[model samples]
Target: MKWVRSKICGITRIEDGLCAAHMGADAIGLVFYEKSPRYVGLDQARSIVQAMPAFVSIVGLFVNAQAAQIKQTFDYVGLDLIQYHGDETASFCEALALPYIRALRMQPDVDIAQVAKTYVNARGILLDSYVPGLPGGTGEVFNWSLIPSLDKPLILAGGLSSTNIAQAVAQVQPWAVDVSGGVEQAKGIKSAEKITDFMQALRANR
Candidate 1:
């Protein structure tokens, strides 16, 4: 619980990216998925990445995108990690030069352990809530009790905010926690005060 890292996902602006990094976020995520409201285009994402200080990772979220496109974006944005939110296969995930984390929408039949084994090359495994048609950013919490002991590092997401983050950390004790809408002023905009509060609450966990 004490060492849990935090990642502020769905960053669309350079100021938000800098705010998250300066406020002690371990990482800042950039959404490349066009369907997502928080989506950042190649030029915008590049600008954000360029302005970010070192030690704060930049993660690019892709939803079943083409291999070439992923490669191009990965190179163009100089992303530190690739987050796969759709139905990408293990080989497909590992084929890239950069490391990645596979985000699983916690559906009924999902076997977290099996997935951990299958995506052996993944740097970490992220668990998010399930919606009927969405790949990620569902903003709904799943039954954490259902998560079993696993081999890989777990990154918990879905509906995490300043209010319940401490409890979620105490319960799951994940390697890292990712939040999007939780610290937002709007769909694609971030609230610095909310981000600070969320990080402070997370740090207060013991």
Candidate 2:
């Protein structure tokens, strides 16, 4: 059976983090970018990290952050992986020395295969919806038809929810699906019921 892994992102509360873990989420994202409403402070991130159970990966998300800031957050939060959500060059991402995923915002004329090849060292290529000013967490779905066959693993994101995840998985058959606002009751706040429903939907499709 091909199981589609799920990651519940934008976790700001300890309870939400634990809920995601308990609900069989493969990973939980912690936002480090201060400008986003879903951003988590170092102390808050630490608390969430400490409270989470083992085996669930802690992914730290950044948006063109300085290396020093990333290192400081890594040391304090003990992130297992990094997700770069800005216009960071492959070299800059590699310099961090941590397993990372590169987010490619899918625009109308973007060349995904070429970008994926460019970031060939990335653990996976995360496809997200391209919004004019926002980096990520846009809560808007892109054209699933635009995705191309690639050499690296694929993690499909952007506007994924309980209602549409199954269809998205059946269409894309990605290694994983990432959700943030889709499972949230409000910005930075997750809804346990939504998470459970989303997982159930994904499992049913698989």
Candidate 3:
């Protein structure tokens, strides 16, 4: 478990958030992107974040939202980290001050080294599948071989299920892995069994 962090995203329900924490999620992502089916309002997010046990982080997901909007969300939810999942510039991301990650939409032969350099100051970089006209949470993985050797921490995401998570952990040995649709019964709904299975797989690999 040297580098096996995991994030459970698209959490809309308080029960699901609690379950993720109880089952040992390193962090929980609350989607603030309105267009996403997994989006949760500030009030709901506030309640869930407030109830989480200590050391389990609360991450807020944004997609090209304004500075004021991000500030509002942070004020209301008190996020431990922010995840930018759209075409946000490094300046926009850096202005937040709070720790954050810039997601790179993985595509065929994308220059990951350049991408990492562009956001060098970010807490980490999240590599996810490239899906046109869609936000994150597609549950479609990109070619893992495309990952370039880099100095920064990489967060592996997309199409990660319990069965393949151990394999992924062994191959990429990423700083963290993110899951949303892969462990879901439907959009915004999660399965506790899937969560347990995914963690078990990660542990077994360790």
Candidate 4:
């Protein structure tokens, strides 16, 4: 069995970021959206990134941000990847000239395959649960059966935790899995124990 890559998102503190990296997480996300409680300031984000060991990817999460904002953050933090969690067009994403992952909120009517095709240049397509008037961190689980097999890598997100991750991996077999609120001690604060358990469960499944 292949190892299921893991990214611990919504990191707001340097301690949490280092904890995730120490626990073997492939990536740690820094939220740049002001509305999100997990949002990190540019200075904080840079500090967290600087604290990380080599080989740990630093991902910047944005929600409906302008190009200038993204560019400003990128120039400062030097994120390994960008995760767009808004209505960004493929051209808009491509214009940044940086590797990015498009987040697709799964509503019943959503055509994921078509969305994936439209963002063909994306490094991966992140499938997250949809909630009315919310961008992400909803902690709601969607129907995994809605996912279709495609050549592009699938990153399963939304409502993932140590309790359900094994079942989720067994069902979806995604290229990667992203978790935020699920392993959190509070909004934006991660628990090292939770992260360790989550990784243990994933390894057990493999």
Estimate TM-scores for all models: 0.97, 0.98, 0.96, 0.98
Question: For residues 15-96, what per-residue lDDT tens digits would candidate 4 score against the true structure?
Answer: 8988889888999999999999998999989999999999999899999899999988988997989999999998899988
Candidate 2 local Cα displacement, residue 119, angstroms: 1.5
Cα-based lDDT for every prediction: 0.91, 0.92, 0.87, 0.92
Off by over 4 Å in 4: none
Q: How well does candidate 2 match the true structure, expressed as C-alpha RMSD?
A: 0.8
Top-lDDT candidate index:
2
Candidate 2 per-residue lDDT, tens place, 111-162, comes to 8889888885799999999999899999999999989997888999999999
Model 3, 100-181: lDDT tens digits are 8888887656787787787757888999988988768888978887788867889999899998898888888899999998
Off by over 4 Å in 3: none
Q: After best superposition, candidate 2 residue 104: deviation in angstroms?
A: 0.6
Which of candidates 2 and 3 is the stronger one according to lDDT?
Answer: 2
- For candidate 3, what is the TM-score? 0.96
- Rate residue 192 of model 3 by lDDT: 86
Question: In candidate 2, which residue pairs get closer than 3 Å at backbone N, Cα or C atoms, i.e. clash?
Answer: none
- Residue-level error in angstroms, candidate 1, position 164: 0.3
Instruction: For each of the candidates, give the backbone clash count.
Output: 0, 0, 0, 0
lDDT of 3: 0.87
Q: After superposition, how far is residue 123 of candidate 3 from its true place, in Å?
A: 0.8
